[model samples]
Target: MQQRVLWSAVMVAALVLAGCGSAARPASPSGGPQQEQRKLVVWDWKSGEAATATYVEKVKADFAGRHPGVTVEFVAQPFDQYYTLLGTAAQSRKGPDVMLFNGGGQIRDRVDSLLPLEQHVAQDRSRLAGWDAFTKDGKIYAAPVTLQGHPIYYNKTLYEKAGLDPANPPRTWDEFVRACSAVKKATGAACLALGNKEGFGIQFFMSGLGSGILTPQEYDDWIAGKRDWSSPHVRRIFELWKEAGDKGLNSDGANSTAMFTDVFRVFESGKAAHIIGLMSDVGHWKDFGEFLPPDKLGVMRAPVVTGGATPSLPYDGGIGYAVARWTKDPELAADLVHSLTSADALAAFSSAAGAISSDTTIDVSRAGPAVAAIVPEIRTGRPALHVALSAKTLDLMGRLSQQLLSGSATVDKAVEQLAAADRAG
Candidate 1:
């Protein structure tokens, strides 16, 4: 996607011992064999999932073709602690040969322990979409697997029940509010499904609605590192977040709800009319399509909140695999990374896991119309606003967002704190 909407890799680093699976032991005294077979250890969150089994098998088969006797062990780590565990492994200098990471600050903050893959992945520059997320100082670190975005996902059946046209979604902020009100009155569904126990709701809200608030030039400038956290439009984002919670748009107990689990269920079960959700993996078209009928799953653009505002997809790299600096064979490890993002492998990932693969060549038409609507928007999509912030700044933003939702912080206060945090970077 280039500057248009570069897909980046969100690597959830996995750690496996170097010696635990290594084949570097000296030849046996008997000369029956020179040494045990080579083994490559990899860490990722998706390896253990049934949905991505085909993807894992594809990469394993591809790598085995290149190196017959080498064993590949994949250890799946819980995402909530993936980075923390990877940190401990990095300090010990005995991390796995390969690991996964989230694109943006998640990968950018830890580049010191990663290998630059530019030379090894040159052949994939034209094939993949999200390289920039894992890149730093003009060097690439990981290959992106999925292009993640925040699109306003709605339940079409709810819209229809509210006497609103499913095909003609709201276009303006006032209109959106009116439509949401209609849904609430007619169907008793919450206007929106939200959870902030992890404080991800603000990230989704900001990115999903940012395009319709910031001008195109302003948006690009923010991505280019000229962020104005104190801008009125930026403050408005926080205001809207607070307003949604206060005005009963969001479901009850939003503060304690886990977005990764409960919030999606609310939307899927027809309790909520809309959610600012992902374009890949869980909480996306595929998950909703599985629950609701495919035709009832709708992807809507951000409503126009300000005059002259234009809406577009907000996304970055989802997750990607990167080679660790301590790996014994950089070339062999890079080969594994290459095989992981290969067309066949990624195609399987897209088909089985419902990921928006970074390999744009993979056809997603069969997945449903929602996927069809999303794929075309990447060309004009902006980098996710939340992804553009530094790690510390984003953490602060999350806390401040939670405070705002809980009535402990005002929009101005939240923006001011974010401005200072961002400036400190």
Candidate 2:
């Protein structure tokens, strides 16, 4: 009887040991649908090095708090190489789930790789402003983060030195040119700092010419081969470009000089009376306080050329965030985009980058004087020709401008080349 009882106890112990072994089996590594991890990766170029680092830290903390099982990783690159790097990563399908896209034709080039945010936008419409800019073929691919508008920034002291009233800025192209010529003749200052290296200075000049040279529909028609390149309006603008270069109103050696930094320095040093690039430069007058006094600065809309069709308006451009079509976690990617483009996030980003937010809900006053001066123009729907052109046309225009400015191509010849390139493209 005792031997039988001992045998029964041993059998029960063995059964308990088998049960423990089954319970200790490892879980599936693939997350098995029930325990999936939530995480996202984002790429942006606007954040300053130090500010981005700090902002990323805060984002991580905040995101983790809101999403107990999720994590976010951010990578910021320099502006010059940002797009190139993104293009490479996208081809390999290793790009960030969310990325910031610079406006212009380039946005069209990468449209296929981007996830349309229409559903997201429909769910959260107020987070967006100027949605028309990011729509292609009726699909929304990006959310505008800031209204990158260009306003003429001039030196108040230089205006006074040229015997011009500092309070009254030029309202027309003729007035602007005369004022510039006066400043150049009186104080030996450069009327404008231009560089062909970046193509922005020339593009800005062309945009200031307004709609007469090419209306949005005309430009589209030209690109589509319906309009002639040698149209009188087109020739007129080309002739005007040549005239500006010949009159000595632009920077010296602008054709060969890739010296954008020097150009900005010249403007800041009061040697150049005006700059017609980003509105942020006005704020830079304060950020780079030693370069120029904030109180000595003035802002105005880029003047309209005499015969242009569209009214003088501030041209706008900026970086936008889009999700990748092949992203493994679309929901998470959408969430990340939503967070970064939120009103609060935009306010923080604008403060960090010294830019204006695309969120109309955010107060433009928050961006301070420089950005505020241009807000009215943005809100009023001033048409800009450059922002309306297709990407291929823009590249051809850039090349043509470079050739024209370098004395390698005549105005008539450049126009022909541009038309030819448009045909080939």
Candidate 3:
């Protein structure tokens, strides 16, 4: 199948305690005849899912082998409530020994309650590439497990039906619109599948299409904490969002569509030609490959909207594991964190869960051409624009995007709100 174009631990108990500040170790008593069993509680949303069972087991097995007296217990929580639970635990100064986090704002915002893993995972640093997302204030707080980004995935079969060359997908905004018009005219399929009900649709649109509209300097600056939401190029992205809806480029009821599976299903069922999708998890090449044949899948850069906008992949750390600051044994917990990210463990995850492992050493050539095309782009990739936004701003953007599509809000108004929010943070 050839689909072209597309896309650490730990220290001694005493040393860790000193590094992490005072924390009690209930498992190890001051004077006991026999040492009590050590249990390291891990919090994450993925372990309960069947897809990652093997990966979790591999990590547990490895950690158990290294630390005979410790037992690892994974507490799977609903992702929607995971952060809330973590926040509660943080306030109480007690929680799981280890916790899983999505890179970017999620982890960055919560670093105050996490132990810095830089010194502990120094050996693994060179083997990983997504450290930026999990880093804050020059300190690394978590170890990345997957690489996530928004990539434009298209259907070659749809392209062919539209009379467009599959190998030559659109490279510019004008060309993309023409191609979409052709697609709608020939096959009657929507040009793009969008699910904004949760507002993630806007986020994906902003990141996926941003590379084409913003210049390289603008893109870099946005992620570097110097966002210019009022820039004409930046404003253009929001305009396109409304334009896509106004032009009927997206499937019907887009504002009510859920991004997780609804938007993907639209594309999967051949109702739409393209989607702004993830790299590692659901809605990615692997998931799409199930419905569309390898040769029918294509990955593309964001179509160039403004001139001089060099197309570069936009991505950052997908998901990672961080040690809770109030753990009884920081060293032991950090060791488990390192074990979870071990090459062998990540390899199992990549194979079983179809994840794009954070370990750069992991072999992925066998995954397919779509992944092949996406991986190399990392060298020129910049962090996603939305990842830099605070959660509050993202929530606001989602609502504003819906308004834009509905003609209730203009680009100027949306940008004004975003600029205010971004500047506030």
For residues 109-199, write the lDDT of model 1, one tens digit per residue: 8887888899999999998887778888898999999999899999999999999999999999999999999999999999889988888
lDDT of each: 0.87, 0.67, 0.87
Give the TM-score (vs. native) of candidate 1. 0.89
Measured on C-alpha atoms, candidate 3 has an lDDT of 0.87
- Please state the error at residue 284 of candidate 3 in Å: 1.0
As for TM-score, the candidate ahead, 2 or 3, is 3
Give the per-residue Cα lDDT of candidate 2 at 203: 65
Candidate 3 matches the true fold with a TM-score of 0.89
Steric overlap count per candidate: 15, 1, 2
